[model samples]
Target: MRLAMGFALITLFCSNSYADGYKLHPGTPTFQGKHFDIDIQEHCQEGEVTCPDVSYDSINKKTGARLHLKGRVMFNPNNYNFQGYIFDNGDYSYVLNPNHSKGTESVQIWNLNVFYKDKVIAFDEGIMQ
Candidate 1:
């Protein structure tokens, strides 16, 4: 029983330690489509765990209107799922599936969901080094 428990603990530890945790850089990356032009910034802090801070400045390119949002994303290490919020409230949120972001030593490919009032307004994807 003790051996099994020890193995389980080690497995959990290794998963957390080895998994590629989120990192945000100083450069803001933007994603533009036919309707939206969105700039995203990840405010990654040293020793940050679970929730990483993020913000967005998005423009409806057609109308020249804008939306600026600030919040954090809660990441599930087990499945690579993420839940994000706008305005620091649960009332506004979006979910990002497995394909949103992928990280390696050299770069991170981010396909983030931009949310406003429980709706996904835009998708911002780019490479950050």
Candidate 2:
């Protein structure tokens, strides 16, 4: 019960941030995970805040296996749902969660548990964007 509440709070803080800061269109990350690091690149209309057609680039930190994927920026304004990016690439489903900090530094958190086909692939974090 306590853990659930804590997770809920964390989710609220992370997802509460607006997309105004993190504009994808060829977005890049300084660090990559052991398995891969996801990027929010291209497929956004000019002058639009949210995008439906989004592209993602991933590269394995160890083997350097780059995974190119495509997804969309989705959300439910009426229901206050996950306002982030998602990819449905067959067996590998990805939710590029918007985990940003709302402090003076004002950066995005890249804590990820990368999994491929129900197998633990790698872990990624320590990204400020």
Candidate 3:
């Protein structure tokens, strides 16, 4: 009985250690698509027209499990402007912008997470749709 109790205690302690070792960073967005995994960090202005910084990481040609890094996105209500950056984890990051600006449209926004097959493929500053 003592041996069994000892084993159980050891197992519980080890499992607890794993849980505490890598707590996912809060505000760390995650996206999972059909062929990619993207993680990003984003910052945005509340109830105002402003651009937030975004950092991204992704894996292409992914068959099973990958990672992506992306940057933040900015939105403008005055001119309906939108722009942002995405980190590809190699070389240069990509930039995105809305085609047109729609002024003072009562915009709503949020950080986004795209998931596919129970895995993260993308992380975006929540949508302002």
Q: Which candidate is the best by lDDT?
A: 2
Error of 2 at 66 (Å): 0.8
Of candidate 2, the 10-residue stretch with the lowest lDDT total is 16-25
Candidate 2: Cα lDDT at 109: 59
State which candidate, 1 or 3, has the greater TM-score: 1
lDDT of 1 at 40: 58
Work out how many backbone clashes candidate 3 has: 35
RMSD of each: 19.5, 15.4, 10.9
Q: Compared with the true structure, what per-residue lDDT tens digits does model 3 show for residues 9-74?
A: 998887656644432344432543333334555555564445455656544322322444545555
Candidate 2 regions exceeding 4 Å error are 1-35, 47-50, 79-82, 100-104, 113-123
Superposed by TM-score, candidate 2 places the C-alpha of residue 25 at a distance from the truth, in angstroms, of 15
Instruction: Give the candidate order by descending TM-score.
Output: 2, 1, 3
Of the candidates shown, which would achieve the greatest TM-score relative to the real structure?
2
lDDT, candidate 1, 6-25, per-residue tens: 99999887765543231122
Candidate 3: list runs displaced more than 4 Å. Answer: 1-30, 59-70, 74-78, 83-85, 88-91, 95-129
Colliding pairs, model 2: 26-42
lDDT of 3: 0.46
Lowest lDDT 10-mer window, candidate 1? 20-29
**TM agreement with the true structure for every prediction:** 0.42, 0.55, 0.32
